[model samples]
Target: MEMNRELIVLINARLVGTDPQYHRQIVSHELRENAVWIGAQLHGKDGTATIRTVAALLHVSPSTVSRWFQPGEFERECEYLSHAFKADGSLKPSIPGRGSGTGNDGQ
Candidate 1:
């Protein structure tokens, strides 16, 4: 999946209601979540979601996105992504307790 402006705008919308003091933390979390989701989607589609690809999609530095997760977290996310799809090959509507990392994280 290609990164589009709509996705960027939707991600930005999540910041509106966040407390200023915790804004950085929230942004970091969102970036990490999105990176994992996107990475998984790409992987499912037989493509790779590199740090640069995810960073570019999120409009953040590659290092910033990299710092958001441990190796274990990424592996776990990848495992989850492997099962995140339906028989039709589309992702499920939601990612269980974790939202889609768009604007659904309760801000």
Candidate 2:
């Protein structure tokens, strides 16, 4: 996957500091967080965002981005569908079921 050069530059610009080491640390953290934010924005109600897409955009490893979607990681901020992402790093169709039904119950 190709990285988004513009986004990378933007993120790096935001991390400019006197300490190069510290800047690198902050950049890594910020990039990971931004990856999650981007994922959430692109995820939509249909889980359209794939891990590889987010990682590629943020210049991070797909596995690293994938970890953020794991249980207890960012569950409160965004819901990650367990079966949504396929092995090929693409999103599968999201089919609503069970609790996803109308609130009126089986009237």
Which candidate leads in TM-score? 1
Q: In model 2, which residue pairs have backbone atoms overlapping below 3 Å?
A: none
Residue 35 error for model 1, in Å? 1.2
Distance (Å) between predicted and true CA of 45, model 2? Answer: 5.1
Q: Tell me the tens digit of each residue's lDDT in model 1 across 1-107.
A: 87899877777778464356577777777778888887777666664557778789889898887778775676567557856755444786764447556766644
- Tell me each candidate's TM-score: 0.56, 0.44
In lDDT terms, which candidate is top? 1
lDDT of 2 by residue, 1-107 (tens): 87799877777677674468888778777876777666656654455656788789887798877665566465334445424445454666545554646765444
True-vs-predicted CA distance for residue 72, candidate 1, Å: 4.9
**Model 1 RMSD in angstroms:** 11.7
Candidate 2 has its poorest 10 consecutive residues by lDDT at: 75-84
Worst 10 residues of 1 by lDDT: 95-104
